[model samples]
Target: IKGKIKHFMWKCYSGILPVSCNLKSKGIQLDEICKTCGEAPETIEHLFFHCSKSMQIWTLAPVTWEGLQEDTQNFRGWWNKLCTMKASRMSDSRIEMTAHILWWIWKDRNWWVFQQLKRSAKEVVLLITLLNFILHLSYLNYSDSIFLSLILRFSLHNTHTHTSRPIVRCRATMDAAKSPPSYSLRSKKEPYLPTLQSDLKSRRASKADPNPLGVKTSGKPTDPSRRLRNRCTVSKKSRRRTWSFGYADPIHLKRLGMWLNLMIRKSYFNILNTNKLKSRKTTWIGIFVKGSRFPVAIPFATSWDNDVVLVKVSPRKHNVLAMFFVEITSAIFVCLFYRQCLPGSLSPKKAAGKIVLCFSGNGSRAGKGAEVKRARGAGLILADSETYGSLFLAEAHLLPATSVTYKDALKIYEYIQSTKNPTARIVPAKTRIPAKPAPFMTAFTSRGPNPIFPYILKPDITAPGLNILAAWSEVSGPTYFVDDHRFVKYNILSGTSMSTPHVAGALALLKAIHPDWSSAALRSALMTTADLIDNEGNPITDAYGKPADPFQYGSGHFNPTKAADPGLIYNASYTDYLLFLCSIGVHNLSFTKCPKNPPHPFNLNYPSLAIPNLNGTVTVVRTVTNVGCRGPGVYIASIQPPPGIFVKIRPSILNFSRAGEKKSFTITIKTEGGFTGTIEKGEYSFGWYKWSGDIHVVQSPMAVSIL
Candidate 1:
């Protein structure tokens, strides 16, 4: 027996099992009546022995005694009698079985009281029997055939009916279940199972015949004996089918469990991959207020490590208070509201040595902080407007400061209104590593389908843009305020300016590794290997928390790790670019003349595909060069077609013999109907095509529009 079970048994013997009577004796206020039967006061003896439910379990159990009724007066007496075998014969297995029965009985009672789940006496007995059998198998070495025969005999005995069929059929079904099915990888047909056919036939026959087994059925079996028999003996065919489904073989079940465990492990690995390239230097702020249990943690982009504790003040809108003397803390300070915290608006006499709260807008975020510093304020809190949503930016401020979302600002406002005297402290910021969902598209990220050249996809890729900590110039104030004099060596900033360096750095690294590859090849490597899923192993979402598409994320968030080994890359030369420009009606170049018949801009061999106008059908060609993989490699094509569009590939497989080998494929896209307006107006339908091999998966985004 497990240590927990032994501990439970010891508690039962000591009369310290927390029964209702014992709880009442301990001064807990409640009726000490039997919770199961509810007919008598609930003592330990009544609960374990005299209760009608417990009595039914004992009767249904295989073990019994003659003087059990007399010993039931007290639990200790009954336990002593059972252990000494004064009322009945006792063996090691029989004693163990009794302990399991008692444990399950207590568990059932608790389940009924707490979860409202009620189990019958016969169900409890069946569970105990299975538990004992498993324990027996673990300790004793038994042959497979012997174990099967024992199980069959127990099942037949419980049914209380005799059948003439040979037991060999059951053994054969169990054997079939143990063996795995055989099928070829290239075969289209699934391997067949004989047991499945038989099971299906049995189900059909049962549905057609009201009494398939020639036994009368009842709507609800009320008699205890009838219910027990009905539960045990539903059908022989069903039992055989259950065994055929791998229940009879523990090894088969173990393999299935292992496969499920592996899938869960893979999912966790995908989530962890989101933080693979996260920066080590980052900073976040925390606001600690009096009377609150936990300090509100605010993730900020840039901040100064200056701590301050002062009385909080929220001045009335546009109200300037005259200087008044009050004895509270080190200084007497006044707070200015959002619009009143601007440059030349704050009265230095009233705002000195205080933290100012300013809402973002009338000025830049950093400008607000700079204005607070000009007034000799100790710190600043820049609250974002609703337009910013959950996105927070890092800005170089002239003073110790942090920015908060509109929602968190509301919480701080409420605290100020409810408190008699509000006091707050700003904890100095420090760097934090591996923030979750790191590469989400910022609310301010530019999205598009290329207004000038509709055939070419815009915003080719994404990278870490929000809250990036980078080196800063110390020549000017952090906020660039003319009067501000503060300087910092490092600062956090956001936007395309920050994201551009990330991609540039990646390109430099790839170029250093493969010095001969062109810029187009480098871009293709990044776009094709980008990740479409976020940290939680789900599709990446936009600022509004909806699943983002190619327009919002381009080819997906940049993944430098996978980009280093992109198996195939799409490359275009200068002439191809000129042709693309000519096809898009940009043929004003003085150095080159336009070709009489220029290739369509969509056929420029770009990493991504975009068809802004698909009147009926369009076929585009693309070429890829195998630059990474060695030896002969074969890749199979898989397509996730855009909604309301049907796409076909000329050749669904690519075979390459060596590095630098090129292969070309054509994609033909058409609407289900002859015309193109099936999807919502002005919305582009999205899809993807992947070329997968044993080692790599090369993917490209596809966008389609009706107008």
Candidate 2:
């Protein structure tokens, strides 16, 4: 049963109990001064709830009743509005405790004012908690829900004052668990965060997420990587007085899962409307940066480091001197769209440094650096025609460029129209931007630079792993979480494990097409074929949603179609792998003989090249096998060297007449003479090597970390 004080207060909020003020307004009250305060007007609310002493008691409470909208003035309206939020609003012990305290305050006031038997307050807070504990134990005598019984058993006491709900304690416990396991945070001198087992008892699982992808989603109860915003650092612990309750009630546990956040704010603006995008996203939507006080926009479009110089075309006529507002209908590579720019009426000779602002619904697929270099545009910016958002552009385009939302473009356009020089500053952050637009790094996704072997990278490739619908046991819930309650034939799961099957499936397809391809050749094909740009045409980012380094996403996202028909493969046999292991100091002297002169660590036949440390000059050797996509294929090299470095490749041209012809090439990297060492700390300069062959344009990324 609910507490007597709480039940009485519920009636008052429900308008059943006649408040003194309403009664007085109806000419029923004999005195106007409150009986408890004597200073304020006598009202039902003031006498029991609004008195200074009642408010003080509320302020002193360890836990509080929150999630109540402050707009409602009357008690009945507020109560009814709160109930309408959920069809089945679960129990909130904190609210009940609040009602009980208000009731006690009213009782104490009556005793002092009418009976003249003044006790300071009706009861101390501990006594009320004790009442709740005793009453909770009583529920086990008749209740039959096992999960409910557990909640009641552990709900007797809580130390979670840091948050409105007990989830604060749950998160803190999970974080502490990640800390050194030798000691427990619960055993510390300060108050410890409580466990989740008790808090989870109150949350009721919904029937199923209404989205079509609901079947493929899973829930995360304790993800330490995702921290709660505005969470308090301090908390209090309930006094430890030994208490236990026998198991008398039982309830079946059910699955609890929700879809991965899409982060797209719901809007009604048509995607095709060039000027009518209405963005509801406000400044308050972003989270606070770690050290910065101000919140940043979650980039819906890729952003660049440089500040934008918003410019508009001259109204008279299309001139080459004026910027070409390119509108690309379609393209396979995002960078390739720049080449599609047609010269305006202005002479091509004077259009060398003109800025081009591209308007597109597909702003996500913006140009990378190499493409910008070829197009020779001074700078570029993509404006979405549908919704307001920034694209989180990661892959560095040589030309300074950024993307803006359709709504923001409208703002820029308005500013341009008003002022002759559109001088609004749009500095989209390259990294450390919020959301990075919404945190995408899930806890289940593995991260590296391998801990054991710091030199080698982990996560060689990545495919979509989040909320994937996969085969499952008939008896299990769709989610793998222990608390999940749903039962379905297929389950939505996420983790490093999900990627394994994807790669395995791709490899199987490749094998079916060409059974003779070696394992290394297959791997090389996948690495080279993988798309360097994301669906948005921006560089793929890490779990944090920030632009990722090579260590995070080796090569890039997988492109299955390209991988299946890779024209050039880095064909490495078992001998190559053996030598790679030897270079890493893996050798057996007693059981197996070790080679004295092992292959250089950088000489492995890998699709991508990474020299961890460069002192001055180093040489890397790579051998590729021609797949005979086009007979008698001729290829020429195109090099994009890192800043302050020069690259040289011996025999820049190669011709292959037969399929499966192997050729080796040597690449030498050397620092520019008399060059000043002025790179950011821990920064790795990026460039690429492209071999334009008769039938294929093969590209390989090169990263150089200066020592």
Candidate 3:
């Protein structure tokens, strides 16, 4: 048997095949009734044996044995009986045939459930018989097993017809089969699988493959290199090509024209037209010391120029052995390591005119440089601790300084210990673009279930925050040290301040495109279109390299491109905000103006949802305005409920007849196992809800704080 068939058998015997009964037993909320017969619960035994469809498949199969229809209690026991059958009744060939039949039955069930395509029992039996014959031939000639497997797989996949187009089978000689297979797509009248050449051409033409033959689609581009970095490019040739596409409707063309016009009017195109701006140079620090082949280039964030010069180490050293053997005057000399180079911690006599080595923690990073400067140290070297991981921050120091990761710090320590005369030079900083695993949560970004209004989520969204290079004041020193006089036109900084501008810039662009949209609508567009994954196609991680939650990342990292045309928006007016304030117990609000029975804070029309005190059941209502196509559109609700919670959405399917049409839905949430009274503070779970349509997918993050 093939590996796939063997694995399927193993899953069946282990009772972990994801049948409805098994899924429900494992805490998944779903109907356990058999999807095929719509009768008995879907179990391993029923799905593969007792169901009417399965029984028909078995009866139609070429192989037969007595007691095959008799109840064996479970799939595992039945499988065990089949394996121990004597050759007189069921031969080894017949057993292999049974496995093939079972595999086909399962595949047919999946097709019916997921793809809404069903095949007759006789068709399934015929396919299994053909597969068994192929396997027998492959067993005789083992070299052709690989080729035969491909044929079996394709045959099984192409069994169901989803379109009116005709399917054609292409044959190859045994010698041709020896080489790798190639595909060629024909017209709709003679539909054939796409070849590699056709696939690449389609990708280059569309810049996207909406219906890849067997490839999985991603939110990010298929090829990273093709992605335009740093700036947006709107060329006339590309615009014309876009217009040529027959699928481009009038609304789409109008939006594209508006976006292009906005881009041209903005500084982005102005800089290109005037050629007044240049790409930033890569900045990094190279540390060169004695007894090393090459200098270690460290990625640093600073607005300083590149200058390389050798410097001597401090002559005054603290020996580790001296602490244990106090009387020993002769000890190996080495540079000292200060846990925190706080004010007055370093002695001027020893630190003067030499680079100081400081560990990161306890004190501010810039303050450490200031302390070294106070002691008349020539430069500073800040070594990160293990907890910091690979995250290095760029700071304007009082002196020439750079930070190194914990791994590199250990190497520096080893060199100082081994070298007799430790001397090094600081290389200038340089810049690098398209950093991987980017758009992550910074350690300093504020997180919350809004302290004052817990039902309203705080830190509404995340953006580029770490090691951001921006214009800076030339009058003040980077570190703002009183005695330090160094200044530059540009500086690299990190924190919520840096991240704020990124979101603000994104909003500015969105506003330019949709001037008629309200502030709340613009915010909704940005939040719903945010990216949850990083550049590396993984969940965005925090500074400590842990997967970030809604509290840390809010809706997600900002994506302006997607925000430009959000399919739907959750709009809220001034009255809505006022009502939200009143519902949250704002005392200053006038009772005469406020509604007698204000809606719950959670019911406010926001892109994201947060239930701060979920003790039992809570139902919240949200409304969305269709802003996509002018024609009819339908969206289906998909929920990834938080752990230990059951979420049920009313009217899971939404239908829109025209643009600007509004629809409302209610989400009812409750604990999985009945209420357990108030939960401990700070205990929460995170999830998301997505409304997927033909052309767009609008997603929103959800956070629930257990009470």
lDDT, residue 145, model 3: 53
Best by lDDT: 3
Model 3 lDDT, residue 105, Cα = 85
User: Tens digits of per-residue lDDT for model 3 on 1-707?
Assistant: 88999999899889899889989998999999998778799988888766766765654455655554454467787877777774456567767877888898888889889999765553565467545654554223555656656765664454233232221111111111111122111222212111110000001111211111111122211332332111222222221101111111122222221222211010000101111111111000000000000011125331111222222111111231111111211111123555578777888877777667788767677788788778877777677666656567666676666676667666666666665655555544444444655766655433554455567664466766556655655555555555656555656565544554455566556765764565578778888988888877898887667898777667887778998888999986544654565576642321112446778878889888888768889999999999984457899999998877788888999999998899999999887786455545557788899999997899988888667
lDDT of 1 by residue, 347-453 (tens): 77766776666776665676777677788876666677666556665455655556666676666555555655444444334344444444456665445555555
Model 1 global lDDT (CA atoms, 0 to 1): 0.56
Tell me model 3's lDDT, rounded to 2 decimals: 0.57
On the 0 to 100 scale, the lDDT of residue 614 in model 1 is 79
Q: Candidate 1: worst 10 consecutive residues by lDDT?
A: 283-292
Task: Give candidate 1's TM-score.
Answer: 0.52
Worst 10 residues of 2 by lDDT: 249-258
Give per-candidate clash totals. 1, 30, 10
Runs off by more than 4 Å, candidate 1: 1-340, 348-350, 674-678
Answer with 1 or 2, whichever has the higher lDDT: 1
Clashing pairs in 1: 282-431
Q: Quote the positional error of residue 396 for candidate 2 in Å.
A: 37
